[model samples]
Target: MSTVPPLNGSWLLRGRDGSLSAYAPRDEAVWCRAERHPGLPWAPPRRIGGDQRLHAQLALGQGADGYAHLVAWRPTVPGESGLVHSTHFRPHLAALDWVPIGHPDRKGDRTGLPAVAVDAEGRAHVFARNKGGGVGMLAQKERGGWGPWRDIGGPGAHEELAAVTGGSGRVELYATTSDGILRWRQEEPGATLVPDEALEASVRPGTLTALPTSKEHTTLFFADLEGMLHAWRPGTDPVPLLLAAGPGRVSALRCTIDDHDCTLLAQRSASGRAVFAACPTEQESAGLWWSESGPQLPVGTRVALAEDAEGRVVAATLSPDGELRVARQKDEPGLALGAWQSV
Candidate 1:
């Protein structure tokens, strides 16, 4: 059995079982079921009212109240789907309570997968692309109610959003348009969201990730279609690191290790092997080094990376054969990784 470990003091890993039902790992091998449909025998056999099949994509964030919030989308039929939200109150608990939020959508709208981030006030902000290719947002109010979905105004078709919270009352959203334009929006507590013009980065038209290093600074990372890895800050030009080109999707996370700012990136090679790299400084002079090889992953496998409170970075991936595997970095400032282990 493979397992997914929660990072950054988080206690839950939201994913789907072999049956496509929502579940959270109770341990390395045991999964606590999240589906509520009693009709589905493979899903813990509960009576919760909602769609049973959860889309493979998930967004997780820790709220100000010390609880972790998860959001996922489920397809209802050929042309409609709905968003599901769940909360984990206690770390030791095995199950989570899930509820539906926002309105259902028709299939043609091509609304991309949703992304979430928790504000300083403990409210959860959700962003997604509308059918018309504009970005839309929904936020949790201070009193525990969900605000109406409103347009944040960015022109992009099939774009994915990534969010990071900085300082006390600031949240930043990043996305790439179909035409390869990078745009961002800044929201301060109760202020309006006015996005800046498209940025001048040679990025491909795909998902991008963002990490906030300070109140006014954030680092963005993305892989071009040719498999070249790139990183960019707000005012500086993008820095490309020397790494092997592969078709694997790129994922990144920023954490402080041994008092040094470390950024970790993971992707799969063309041979279905996992590769990892670490950069300890703002400049690319340190260069990129590959970690020890792991077991072969399925082609086009998706990977997720997170850092724990101890500054250890953990990576999780679902193999093409439906097995979930995990691995961790050995120490700080070194690109070495432990052998991949199944749950």
Candidate 2:
């Protein structure tokens, strides 16, 4: 049988245009600016709203009321470290038209990476990593200013946080922790953040996808450190074994557990081989869902280029052909690859 052809696309994008944007603290206001990209000559960056430095981990969230509410937390500098001095970034609204937000708070000297969630009424919840290396207080945004910052629960330690709209006035916060992923209630009675539960995955920075389990239900997916991924819920413990180990360090982890689509994409450092493996939980023997971008070519190290909805894979490498190469499963019962592309 002939090998099936997989999808084709460009190499992973890199350059100045890809620089990361961060929210920094000005004297009494927060400055939303671009900082970390391969090469964009930004003019010392710019400022926007809020008073404290927001964490870079807060990805751009949903926009509403003609404004994009940025969620961020600032860690305390070593000297002024304390529960009182640690957190500095306060949540605020940035107008869709590009108007700056709050005045910088000179008195507040501390901040950390804060997980942010905004509700239907534009209420924002800010959670931070603190001086003692624990999760910090929860703060909210009211009208044009920030309400007082309240301690959610140092008990529930979270490195990354995800917030989504749920029940009556309640917003939900999901977090990744050493013990597992956990959650806390917000916007209602018992809205205090506590240890919701353990996550199935054993790490942070995992890609999260929201799934609707029932008419009024939803779940999340996250990958662990060992290349394994898990399905999680706010109060329930993570369900493990969602995705088995892939080709390399989980450069790209995807879970369609809601659809049983447990495909993991990775790259091998030693062989410069790209792998696309299927991770079936019920079947222990499904083994690796892999493809070699250039096992035959002189590849120094493999870097995952991209993967799509159809389980197709692409990788980039420093080979004679080009930096970006192609790897796809052919119809011959195994995966195959062609030459590399310049882009």
Candidate 3:
């Protein structure tokens, strides 16, 4: 059984050189900490605060240039929230000041967390649930300017949206709605986003995850209303993979183990402990088994997975109390984890 550790969602960023920097939202501000090198201890945390009050978790997206792009919802008065963005130019460095990227509907109420994905040309596409229950998108232009918000309609859109840039540089997006799951795909790099009618997959809100398993193909994973994990690619029916105990956002990473392509998944179980599973990439028909990894986490714990500079899989967990813990892939046989390091 593989023992993959857990993290506090996708907030963990791995630089090109394998340095790790972790970010999280605490109250009205966001904080960051980083390790200068692969085996170095984490430096002290730094606060990246803004004037507005943050109402949602920070969403991170990295571009080809290795800059960390962040988006967060800041709600001032009732029914008035705006999205703010920041960029961490490099690991262990100060990020640019937070800039406002106003919400889709200026006065929209009940707006959820925003999703961001950086395209091949370094454009940051931002998606949020608008007041009309549809998705509103604002993307960066090729010339480094922000575009006007476009309502890429998805009625009854709920929770956080999922956007990913495939290895082919195409941007794909997924959103869960009252009726079913919705998607938007870019025809090519720098192309306009086109939405597909909602897929019939009955995914629980906030449980959707998109993992690019190949150069040009991506797979979608999520827990159904009954807590069953399913994997689906475009034009294919949802393939049942695991019977998770509850439904929540699942963190996934596509990497190779012993030269075999694998997709690893992590989620907080109903018991508040983190569990993991791995399978052949894009081969859900093969088979899978889940293993409990880290100890019980605090409420609102998020998990994330990434490969380090030495090609070792790393998992991180962030607790509600602002504690960040990490474990890396051990040097043994199948996927195993080293001791958890709190920093």
Candidate 4:
């Protein structure tokens, strides 16, 4: 049996101008490729920044300005120390060099994979599991600097954390803990995030993810211990969605299809094929459906989903052999997907 790998972070990003940029970890460094337009061929992958083996998948977070922020956590070695670093990508400009964000610990390197979300004002907030199994965060200062790492509190938090900017411009965070789900919400845009004990559920740790459904609301999704998928939001109980065919992480993105607002999802199935599902935004109770969309992924693959400038949903997967497969939403009807293209 092929063992599943740790959950990889978001590797596909859509810039403000409708161009798509894909990133992957390779040869102790991160590589990037971009499309000038929707139907144009993707540029060959190019390595970005200096070489340092990443400890987890590269995390991409974009602000309202369409700038993509890249974050990664790397291990320390004899002559070097492990740390979390970040850089930003903007169209027509070279990517900024990776700047060390420091580890969660001042005297030690006990940090897990880093997750980041850029706020409306373009400040990048990065989160990682600390030495005490709690989440620590470092945010960009509006005046132009990085803030100190602070423990945001998640006593038994899992390493797979998801951070996203809500439609209202505030940032929200969700993490699966030993007890239930822990969430942090910003009272307002660029404000401090307050912690709350989210509605309890038996969430399979790495499968926890969130999709912003409205300016003030976001829906959380995860598989239960039995591989059953459920969707939940504040003030409501979890609405069971469907049974997942595997134990892989779920990637969800809010998009529009046939003039209707919808939420699209992608996950690697038990047989190693990438599968997709969709439903009207926040209407999982109405009806939700899933189908296989691409070729079998190599062992340990995670599908990343994003919406391009043309309002079509795009799914991407990076295989172990360094191959990138992409699929886009077809225009015909409900959640139809075009053939997978290897770039």
Candidate 5:
């Protein structure tokens, strides 16, 4: 039988360059870097941090800070710990230097999933789950510096997918909770976060994403732990849709509205292979849910999918054969994007 590695972690990025990098922790006390690019296939995974075994959410893109950040969590005590993300890249020292965000309840405990989101204003909002007191902080990037975390709402991290998006109308913050989906407009005065139970009723998931597909509209998509992909209109509930079958795991996703219909792209692994499942159907159970696979990408690849300014489906997958694959057409001319050399 082919040995299958445990699927417990995930990675995300923003760009489609030949060389794209993301972070994951293989062993305790260390985090490793996985990269992909063109020309040379990627090398094997390598350790990138000295004292981080757990990674909340790793992103390989310039944040609102306009700087690349790689943040991870490390074990502190028993149930308590903290996270650190890079605000500045240290070229001379080798690995990027980092600054700690905060510690857990019990001195050094493992606080699950410390996610950081940087808005267009360069404000880095770092959140974590189970920080005790059912409370999470919303820290502002004051003077482009970290620290001074202020309290927001909710108990602990609530694990909401928080983000900021703008159109011709205004910029708004979007998130999902047990109460359903909620919104808070930044541009509007006295903007209060309110629940959209109708929208929430549509969202039968734990993950969501909001991306601008046109010059004036934004859409959100999600896939709970289950491999189902759903889309939410700007002010509507999630229209659940089936995307794939088999014991497939969705690694990455993106949603962008095109004209009247919305498009969702997700990276999924099934039957020991990696494939991109892009749906054009506005209905939940519509479209072919197309996927591509070959003999080479057996270890499966991590898919980082996104939509361009034009709203076309663009996918980036790091193949088992070390190729950094990108494709616009689900049925494309090549099998992989480009070969990446390992370091």
Candidate 6:
């Protein structure tokens, strides 16, 4: 398979294209390709949308119905940007013909990257930062239309939104405010979003990443300004799991192995290498272990982790030179990862 940089964020979804489709940004537009199987070469990349003004950031998710969803914004004028586009790929057709989702903010207002999550009923919830630094959301209507953007009050300015689905019909969201406070929102199927208090006690600003471990639990991960990685489960106290001791970021994903809950974390080390850690949901603190699964990655390299069709954990990283490298964990029970191989 060919390797490409995650210029606009990358996503892997099953049942699309050849049962596995990968999406990323190339040049001024987003592109995607797929493979029939994990070990096979990928098909040629196909451009998604957005022309000369396409932004370098994008969000992707897949719904229960097996449709791949994508969202992005494009610049319209100097100091003014408006258009927010949404698109999806039907596994049967294997195409990404985009359609415009009405802009939530005014024409000249700055906007953050869009985050999307799908509920049990196949409805998509999209969240983003509005001009006033509060969170705004749009819901997909059952009649195949998008509802108007509603301002969900929160304290976050110019921060990307992260969201994950919990249980059958619950969704949770996270975002960091300009002042360094991480806020959250939760909702049930067909219910309004209820804002929750700040999550981690630390007021140091940082990005948020989250995944649902089970119907009753979801895990949030973030690296503070000090580059220390923290994991928080809603009802429990926050834990500082990894210390970067320097500047870097963390990415994580939740998956199942042999019917056990598993989570994988990739953090950039102080020395500019990507380090990995794995632990079960019940042994978050006791069984936490690290491994050198791949070569040293450049600082700020983007990492994405997901379970392939065969239920093996697959980690993909985009290097500074625009190459995508992949590594997979063996089917065994330990936190062991195979060597990195170029996509």
* Stretches > 4 Å off in candidate 1: 1-51, 64-66, 75-78, 94-96, 104-110, 167-169, 190-192, 243-245, 256-259, 331-333
Q: How much lDDT does candidate 1 score?
A: 0.58
Per model, how many backbone clashes are there?
A: 2, 35, 9, 0, 23, 2
* lDDT minimum window of 10 residues, candidate 1: 6-15
TM-score of each model, in listed order: 0.76, 0.46, 0.93, 0.92, 0.64, 0.86
Q: Please write out the lDDT profile of model 5 over residues 1-343, one tens digit for every residue.
A: 2332222223434333433344443444233333343323434555554434554344232343334445566545676557665642321123554556765342456444444545555455555444452334444544666654443444422444444334433334455555555554444322322322234343443455555555555566565545566666655556665654334334433353333344545544565444555444344456535565533344545555544334444455554333455454333332233332223
- What lDDT does candidate 3 reach at residue 13? 79
Candidate 2, residue 110: how far the Cα is off, in Å: 5.8
lDDT of each: 0.58, 0.41, 0.80, 0.77, 0.45, 0.65
Q: Of 3 and 6, which scores higher on TM-score? A: 3
Full ranking by lDDT: 3, 4, 6, 1, 5, 2
Q: Cα miss at 146, model 1 (Å)?
A: 0.7
Ordering by TM-score? 3, 4, 6, 1, 5, 2
Query: Where does the lowest 10-residue lDDT sum fall in candidate 6?
Result: 1-10
lDDT of 4 by residue, 3-103 (tens): 33243456788777778887766556677888866557888777665665665456668888878788865666553344555564553345776677787
Candidate 6 Cα errors over 4 Å, as ranges: 1-10, 16-18, 50-53, 90-93, 156-158, 178-186, 245-249, 257-259, 331-333
TM-score of 2: 0.46
Show model 3 residue runs off by greater than 4 Å.
1-9, 49-52, 76-79, 108-110
For model 3, how does the per-residue alpha-carbon lDDT over 45-141 read when each residue is reduced to its tens digit?
A: 8877445567646788888787788888777578666788888877777788888888788655547777889888888888888878888889887
- Winning candidate number (TM-score): 3
Q: Write the per-residue lDDT of candidate 6 for residues 1-343, one digit (tens) a residue.
A: 3343222223766654335666776565776666645557666666775344466667776676777777766666686665455556543243544565656674554476777887777777778777777878888887788788888878544466677777655667777765544445555584556777565355344446676777687777766666566777777777777664334335676777667677777765656566677778735785455565577776666676766677677777775455677777786766567887776
For model 2, residues 194-284, the per-residue Cα lDDT tens digits are 5544445566453443332432444565667765655555555665544533322234433343346444445453344444444543232
Residue 151 alpha-carbon offset, candidate 4, angstroms: 1.7
Candidate 4's TM-score: 0.92
